[model samples]
Target: MSEKVISDYNGYDYKKEFWENVDREYEDQADRMAIRRLLPKRMEKFADIGGGYGRLANEYLKRARKVYIFDYSKTELAQAKEIYGDKIETKAGDIYKLPFKDNELDGLMMIRVTHHLKDMPKAIAELYRVLKPGGVAVIEVANKRTLPKMVRYVTFRSKVNPFSKEVANYKEISADGFYNYHPKYVEEIFNKTGFKRERVLSVSNFRSKTLKKVFKTNNLVKMEEAAQTALAPIRFAPSIYYKLRKPEK
Candidate 1:
């Protein structure tokens, strides 16, 4: 078989370069709020797939008996190990070929990682295989059908179709394989992989630079919390979070 495309962050300091800033505090809090609502109250084995430097590990650490940060970067994993030490386990592996055995995880989450995946179906199947029956998985996607993009399409300002249920790639925006996917397409893949849709939350609804400049981060986060569930049906947000479960036989 041919080798699968992987978005390797081996030498990158994702936590420092991407997250350590005042500008994205609202987005970070918005994500955490959604995750808190979706994640199981308690679990035996929980993992954060593509959890670089364990940025969100503390969210699940108290809830799960065993928490792991699994990623494709040794550098990130090493950082995770340094920060978390024995509190959380770190593993380096591909999303399509996870190291965990079948039915080993009580719950798992893959946030901000879907866009990097070239074979989403294969990666999702691996998640289904590892999660126990009735286990929950929280997956996040960069949405192609955002309101701004739709407006651009309708106004003849952009060539891409926002209504189409296909993956949208703009290499010019980010050459590192950044993709935006339609929500329906992602849901269909999850359903095909035997996952039942539990809930959907529209995160980062107010991710405008102008809005951030005008309002405080906490106020924006409060607005985001209120809008996540209400705006989910329309799915006009740039980031969409899905709560899925594997049914018990």
Candidate 2:
């Protein structure tokens, strides 16, 4: 939240072209769907931290009075500017030291950014500071402990793992940069940052290319109904969605 904390985390140049490609490629279909679920009916001003390419920000603009899209990468901002025009504001800024005043934003959505953050607590505190009382924050993070993710780690040795030598050497960097998170870790971080946890949802409880193909058959609504009923009670869904709020009074 202070200048030093902000400065320390500012070294990652996400605005570069190469990183933008990484981010766009690593973008998750499930996260896009989850953000749609948590979106507010109407927001005065919404800020999206680490919103690469502004996909979610573009969607929020339709319902928000004003939208601000912040990312450390200028390359991503270029695409966002093309897609949004003047409807959305793009700023190359660090998430830890948001360039906004206290209680200045109505809502915040941080999609797939927790792992890239150098200090989760400081970043969340900044988000809490900028958000007005009753403002909501929705965060999307990969489940480090999920069965699918663990299998992927061992079998793929891909960008999803922060400890892999392949990823550590930057052979392949995930679109969002360094990401390492556990499913329940978010609750602890949010509570430490003064946000009260509200709702939690899971996505892609059972995800696989072959399984997805099966669900894509006859009726989309029926598939959704069946999946929700079957997976809603399960604790370890593939991806986790957290809805939190800044305390009022």
Q: Give the range where candidate 2 is weakest over 10 consecutive residues by summed lDDT.
A: 162-171
lDDT of 2 by residue, 21-99 (tens): 5533213445555667777778998988887677666557777898888987776777778878998888788886788
Per residue, candidate 1 scores C-alpha lDDT tens digits across 129-248 of 999999999999989999899899999998889899987877776666677899999999998999999999999999999999899998998899889999999999999999999999
lDDT of 2 at 59: 59
Each candidate: what lDDT? 0.91, 0.66
**Which runs in model 1 stand beyond 4 Å of their true positions?**
1-3
Candidate 2's C-alpha runs over 4 A off are 1-29, 149-177, 210-235
Error of 1 at 155 (Å): 2.9
Q: Indicate the worst ten consecutive residues by lDDT in candidate 1.
A: 1-10
| Highest lDDT scorer | 1
